[model samples]
Target: MDVAINYLEENFAERKIKIQAQEYLHRFYGSLGFKQVSEPYLDDGILHIDMLREK
Candidate 1:
């Protein structure tokens, strides 16, 4: 996941990355610099939130 984001940011010149992170893993991703962009919501029976990281 880290390598993928890196490629998008470096090779693809992506300024923003968006993800629908599962609630439980939100903290893990947050530690990697993702920030919540939306309140938690249900998706496919799991809680999720919109997250984004800006490069």
Candidate 2:
């Protein structure tokens, strides 16, 4: 994940990145600069939430 994010930041010129992550893993992503952007929701029966990283 770190590698992919670094690749985007270095090469893609992206404004922001968004992901639907498992709710319990939010903290893991938060360490990578992602912040929760949505309330908990279910996806394919798994609890998940939206997160985003802005450039």
Per lDDT, the best of the predicted structures is 2
Q: Tens digit of lDDT per residue, candidate 2, span 1-55?
A: 9889888878988779999999999999999889999999999999999999997
Residue 32 lDDT (model 2): 89
Q: Superpose all Cα atoms of candidate 2 onto the true structure and report the RMSD in Å to 1 decimal.
A: 0.9
Q: What is the lDDT, from 0 to 100, of the residue 52 in candidate 2?
A: 98
lDDT of 1: 0.92
Error of 1 at 41 (Å): 0.7
TM-scores of all candidate predictions against the true structure: 0.91, 0.90
Tens-digit per-residue lDDT, 1-55, candidate 1: 8998998988989999999999899989898889999999999999999999987
